[model samples]
Target: MFGVEARALMLEGVNELADAVQVTMGPKGRNVVIELSYGTPKITKDGVTVARSMAFENRVKNVGAALVKQVANATNAVAGDGTTLATVLARSIFAEGTKSVAAGMNAMDLRRGMNMAVDTVVEYLKSKAKTISTPTEYAQVASISANGDAEVGDLVAKALEKVGKEGVITISEGKTLENELEVIDGLKLDRGYLLTNFITNTRTQKCELDDPLILVHEKKISEASKLKPLLQLVVKLQRPLFIVADDVVGEALTALVVNKVRAGLKVCVIKAPGFGSYRIDHLLDFVALTGSKLISESTSLKLEDVTVEMLGNAKKIIVTKDDTIILGAVGDKQVIQERRDEVTSQLKKATAKFDKEKLEQRLSRLSGGVAVIKVGGASDVEISEKKDRVVDALNSARAAAYEGIVPGGGVALLQASRELDKIKTTNFEEKVGVQIIQIAMKIPAYIIAANAGYEASMVVGKLLEKIENDSFGFDAAQGEYVDMFKAGIVDPVKVLRRAIQDAVSVSTLLTTTEAVVYPNYTSNSNSNLHYN
Candidate 1:
């Protein structure tokens, strides 16, 4: 297919997907009941979840739906929220772009103009963003992201307070009816186990060890002789051993894998975090935290000469494909504090942004602590749904802390649309692109109002009348116009900016496309198929 016909079919698909997703846009938005392949049907207000569940029988339309789905996923991956808004924006932009193209507008010029408008909107959002530092501010952001769940907001606020801005906050299902938050002393590393054979929990794809003896090595271990003594010592002690090393290869890695598989020894190996000087600093931090000796050439410590006393101890160690978390580390408080102080001192003196960030991460790991929010519900499906919301809220809270926030309920985007009028366009096609985005920005607030059973156009018009006050927006739940920020309705600038960026990126590509190709399956084709 080519030209208007192809674009029209794609736009229809975009509309179908967006129509289902936009309903779940605001606090008063309706929940979508999704039929599952097994067990109970899933009911959720998460836009990305709804988008992921949708498929079309028409291949051409399915292609369009898939592109919109990519926008949602990309937004989710970056900002962890605003996926619904991203989908809505993508559909609006592509639909408008399609109309312009059909009217003899240059597709490339439209794309260029769309990019310019988006960049301007992003800058406007940044200028208008307000940095949030207090726990109350965090709760407000969390509450809005979780669809006005005050309980979730409170839990997330508590979690962020306990963990600090740079610290890790994870969400999990709880055993009880009430949500719970727990703070623990732990260290998380970016590196994970070197081999899948080290995984002890197949269900979670993680290697979990209880009361493990941690061995921190600064250099690679390639010989069996150097590892034999440590294995023997761990076996004699009857304790699981966790190895953090520069690299484990050749006979040394093979020996550990064989011991894990055949000898039934509980052992896991992971590469040390960071690179070069950063790696050494991270290893040093780990050593200080675990009360282990740093096996480095500068210290004249050889792998063969390592003893049980040199190993660090931890209450529990969990290793996954991309990360490792050590909980309840058995380190002296004084030593850990001293290490933290050293990192703090270095952080103050660091001039490079990269170095400062790395130092801040070290300090956070040493002092900020870790928080786990266990989301609870009456049923499995309820728990799953709530957990998703909690995770999104937590991520949004973090993003808000990083890049600040803007008036939400789509007011920010609507106001941003006004700035597009100031942008200079070289051609009529380019001007149409700017107009497309200008119109698209208003769609979110409109859909949000319509979802709450109000007259969408009236709400949008009233809000636009007060464009001078950028924060003024329709409070759909209360059927009133209010200051969004003062009403505790806000969005992270990072989320909003990313949503628009990803939406326009994919939507413009779809707008410019002249043709699409799909497979032509026929009778008597091979039962098994392969793709590359």
Candidate 2:
């Protein structure tokens, strides 16, 4: 167990990580070149990547850094942008809360204040956000996120506009031109293989098949004898087969592997998608996707029941541990429509117990189209950096399209902080919480100013006096106060809200951390390090 010393150590570590990350905060911020021990160096301003690249000699600092990295990861996961801002905000809260904790302020009071501050800031952000409808507004958000790359922004905005809001966007390295975006028909499946045995080509870790027949079965195939007739049919037809079943156990699995590896028969077997009864929906979706027949053991138990006419044909199927994506699927529009209608009706009938995101995603998959922005650069490092920026732009544009936009350049947060400061709170805990967030709000502007070679204190003071105009804030690049929206500097409201919420959560947890227990430390240790 540890007390003051541990807290100080933790704070120092946190401060170090914050110092390393916050430098890459705003548009005026500089890029960090991360040199790995066994790879080419990477140059990026992405906060999450930078934080992950950092190493601390001080064990305490490393521990602190690890905790704060959660903020970056969570922010990236939810909004896909604002990792740096979130990290900075969290550091500020943790720093401010540390002072309060040292002054004998109750941890519970600080935690309570943080919660209230999150609610207030979120509400304030919502109030300030402007609805985004036009492609131009989306372009602005994307441009800012892409580090002022107008081409990337314009391309992403146009792609999203063409594909509609429900459409998916993905990025890949390109061979020609700095890049281009293409819209193609496709669907994403959440079900992926856990074993590599299904992949016939070990060199590429891929199972390549041409016009493979799909078998959607409802029961487990435990015996090789049960699968023999189907295997013989695949051999007779001289075409690859894809079997989707509940489970292919022991002899059945071995037989398929032998037939594929030794006899050179193309066979790929994967467990039917989804969990429990939901697996039925997945199998149905696959049937709709490929226009395959729904074959179940409940309907026919005999091997002869599997006929060539009963199987569906797919152009290609790719599997990975995370997910499976079927490409060039020959879709039956009528069948897809029927399945979509069924899923929609199920969704309408679904209670809160049903997973809404999953259902909605399934519907989107059924709709079927993906826009890919293949980013290209002169060098590997450039490509990597450009890829991150384009992805951020894509995600930021999507968020803006989904939720709307907020005034950026730290204007929204500063405005909310000031508004909270003016709020009259009778309770001491509430007042303290307001004060902590209020102070923390200025951190973004301060860091932005400092990064741009301006006096942070002077810039923050100037911006504070312009509170009358919520849109006006210190534009570090210009070293003057201006309207963030007019300057084409805006962020998705969802990104800011996610950052603030995660920051408050992590900061509150840090404040309540009273001790650091090193599990590996023992009194019997002969090393110099000692703890009591």
151-248, model 2: which lDDT tens digit per residue? 88899888888666666676889986578888766666656663677775678777667778888787787888878888899899998887778878
> Tens digits of per-residue lDDT for model 1 on 1-532?
8889888988889999999998888989888899999999999989999999999998889999999999999898768898999999999999899988898889999999999999999999999999999999999999998998989998999988888876767688999999999887688888988999999999999999999999999999999998998999999999999999999999999999999889899999999999988899989889988989999898898888889889999999999999888998888789989998898888888888678768877887887478889988899999988987898899899899989999989999889999999999899999999999999899989998998999899989988889999788878888888888889999999999999999999999999999988775656677744321
- Lowest summed lDDT window (length 10), candidate 1: 523-532
TM-score between model 1 and native: 0.76
Give the local distance difference test score of model 2.
0.80
- Range of the 10 consecutive residues with the lowest summed lDDT in candidate 2: 296-305
Q: Against the true structure, candidate 1 has what lDDT? A: 0.90
Q: State each model's CA lDDT, in order.
A: 0.90, 0.80
Residue pairs with colliding backbones in model 2 are 13-61
| Top-lDDT structure, candidate number | 1
